[model samples]
Target: MSQVRVQPTADAIRAGARAIRRRNVEIVNAAGLGHIGGDLSAADILATLYLGVLNVDPDQPDDPERDRYIQSKGHASGVLYTTLAAAGFIPDSLLDTYMADGSPLNGHPDRNKVPGVETNTGPLGHGLPVAVGTAIAAKLDASPRRTYVLCGDGELQEGSNWEAIMAAGHRGLDNLVAIIDRNGLQQGARTEATNALDPLDAKFAAFGWAVRTVDGHDIDELLATFRAAPFERGRPSCVIAHTRKGRGVSFIEDRVEWHHKVPSAEQTAQAIEELSE
Candidate 1:
């Protein structure tokens, strides 16, 4: 069967992202914990994938032929959970159980517990390797299924990711795509302060991957980029998505401390207000 690309309208994509952001704030406020900075920064990317790009069935999430998505920057589980609910993978009510005792929703994603999750991932640099293997398997079977991994820019400093980059490039795994959430800030400081990832596009290019840098929050650009994955016929694809931490909330925007900070009631209300517009 020929692939029919998914292309949701830009307005629809923006609405989806708004809902994800609103719900992410709600979940964090309820649980009194979350990585809101990264969650907000990557919310649009997550929304784009779940609402349009991914070939996933909410009712049949485990289908072998489904395209795969691994959230490499797993600290932002709130956005992942909110996106999953928005995509109908889980009941929206399940979001209430997040960070609660015995709840399947942990601070990091657990595929064994989440129906739509492709693999358990939290540690930085792990998802790409797993994605590489999955993409290799798809190639071996001659399946057209694709695999995507979203990693934080700071996470790129981990050595394991380069290893996967090398392997994917060397193997010509064109079925895979890696997106970096380039929000600039990490947990304790700016990514540049801790470890610079400048020249990131060139580095990926050096590894033999086709690279593109895009406005991560732009729904239209995100949809276009995802659809154009495997930019080169025999090479993997990499998208460096420049984003801002705490994107929808004016006060917290680009603030490093918001990485795991729970929003206060007033702050939550303000954030929801901005997102509503």
Candidate 2:
């Protein structure tokens, strides 16, 4: 413990999430590079996990029994770094070096440098497979600790994820929970036009996962849905969190161009103000 501890309720998680968004805008504005849209969309989910749900303790990051979290949508690292800072895994000051030449805060997370990250993740479709392995290890050890992975809707196009999905389902990795930040837009266009994943829930169900759909931005709903995991016994869980890219900021919300765009000084201020409320 650096300072942060798991918050007791959904309201506390929501408040921390707002702070995360405010700091995330600043982090991107200062660093001059970031996947702002996806970062904003996943802020609530990350915050809820780091601050309210995951069994990770900042001081005991490598505790064998601690829950594992992998950011499969690794491009949105600004939010991940900010959430880690808020969770006390890293000092808030370390965030100032994000994306800098010698910084550990790279464009994507590296477990070697980051205390809470379970593994290196940047390439799409790789994390869930790694998470499936971790969950399998836990099963072998008979540990109660869970494995969670957050993925991007766009990356679902990769065949590797499907393979991992099939393996987890077939092995009955009920300890695994995969959350897709289903914000619709991906990079320059919408996921539907690019590679439709609309029947995502049915796909997961068919893959043998207990599926649940929730408003990704609704903190209370997300918290409740996550807590009620593995909707069925002996099955993996898939949470399709429908969200808008650039969720909290009015001008940036759902704008595809903002996917990797840096906010101007004025826009950053406006975003911070909006998040403050």
Candidate 3:
């Protein structure tokens, strides 16, 4: 099958991003709970991947040679689900069932039920290894498909990601790209107050990754970064997306308390209004 040419215009990309954030907010508001902070933080990156970069078809989600997208920071499943729905990977109505009993859309992403989700990830640091394995398989099969994993900055505290990093570099898996959502804040508090990953870019470089740091909310920057593939001939690439938790909403941005806080009805309305502006 020929790869679908992704000539995502800036307006379309922005629309996708808005749709993701709006849907995420709606889901969390309906469920009366969710990791909205992280969800909002990663919305732009998710939009860039699903709508701008990935060669995936919502109609043929199981195509073997299609690019893979894994959400390593699964707690933000709200964002992933909304992104999938916005990108047509799943019915938009299913978002209403989020966190409901027996619904496939749970608090954490499940690969079994979600068509576009590449792996079941709720535990931190699991996505990189899965992505690395997928990248290796693509290489072995001589397929041009690439693997992209979105990992949270706090999730990097887990040692497994480092191991995966080493393996990807050692095997020269240039098909793999890891995008870190560096929103600074974690569940309990700021990442710096807990475990600092200040030298994150250098760490990836030391592990032999070609690193690119960009503002996660900028559509132009994200599009450019995603398109500039294979920064190094024999090395996997890592994009440190510096983002703010609760990015689009002013009151919530960078607020650690919003990590798992469900916005009140009034706050939700305000947030939606703010995003629409």
Candidate 4:
């Protein structure tokens, strides 16, 4: 039997994002490792997609007709795991075992082990290509299912993404939507300081994509943008969402060093306290 999926209100989804963030901090702190910065950066995006946009039935995870979502920014597994648990794709008990010995929850997501994950993706440039292929397959099957991928801005420097972008546009895979977490910071430094992706929208547009930029933290805007897919016919849509790394935490926000830093017990308490507010 398929689970009922009543879409949450935008405000409710926003609260869900906050809960996801708090859970993420707890699990990451307990596990002593996580890409927390990126996890925080993309929380709102993940929550908005799972709770209010995607047509997924957690109880029927392998529903062939369900929409496909690829966490292209896979290192941010903390956020994804929390979102999956919150969305009921996985049990909340599973979170306590994150990264434990023999735990199904690895540092990076594994499709074979995790429910709601469409494919295995951890290599920086791989997810978009897979999502493009998924979108193309849906088109060929005449399926209404759509494919959405979340890529980090830093990963866009990979040549393979452009190749996939070129292919998606050329094929006019209007069912495909690629959302870039434009947080500006990567693991080591600001994206511009490492390898700039400024003019990113123009770059995608040049490849025949219809592009729109939105504040990634804005739940209402995110819901509206994602549901209004295929912003133009005959073009894959790209939503470049501007976000702050380590969002919602005053000390860590936008600081590059926090990319994969494990928070101390005190910091974790503070982060949880702030997120609960």
lDDT of each: 0.91, 0.91, 0.91, 0.94
In candidate 1, what are the lDDT values of residues 99-144, reduced to their tens digit?
Answer: 9999999999998998888888888889989999999999999999
Model 1: CA > 4 A from native: 1-7
Name the best candidate (by lDDT): 4
Q: For model 3, how does the per-residue alpha-carbon lDDT over 107-177 read when each residue is reduced to its tens digit? A: 98887998988889999999889999999999999999999999999999999999999999899889999
Q: How much lDDT does candidate 1 score?
A: 0.91
Each prediction's total of clashing residue pairs, residues at least 3 apart in sequence or on different chains, is 0, 0, 0, 0
Which candidate do you rate higher for TM-score, 1 or 4? 4
TM-score of 1: 0.97
Q: Point out where model 4 deviates above 4 Å.
A: 1-4
* Deviation in Å, model 4, residue 60 alpha carbon: 0.8
Give per-model TM-scores: 0.97, 0.97, 0.98, 0.98
RMSD of 4: 0.9
Comparing 3 and 4 on lDDT, the stronger one:
4
Displacement of the residue 142 alpha carbon in candidate 3, Å? 0.9
> Per-residue lDDT for 96-206 in model 4, tens only?
999999998998899999999888888899999999999999999999999999999999989999999999999999999999999999878889999989899999999
Say which candidate scores most in TM-score. Answer: 4
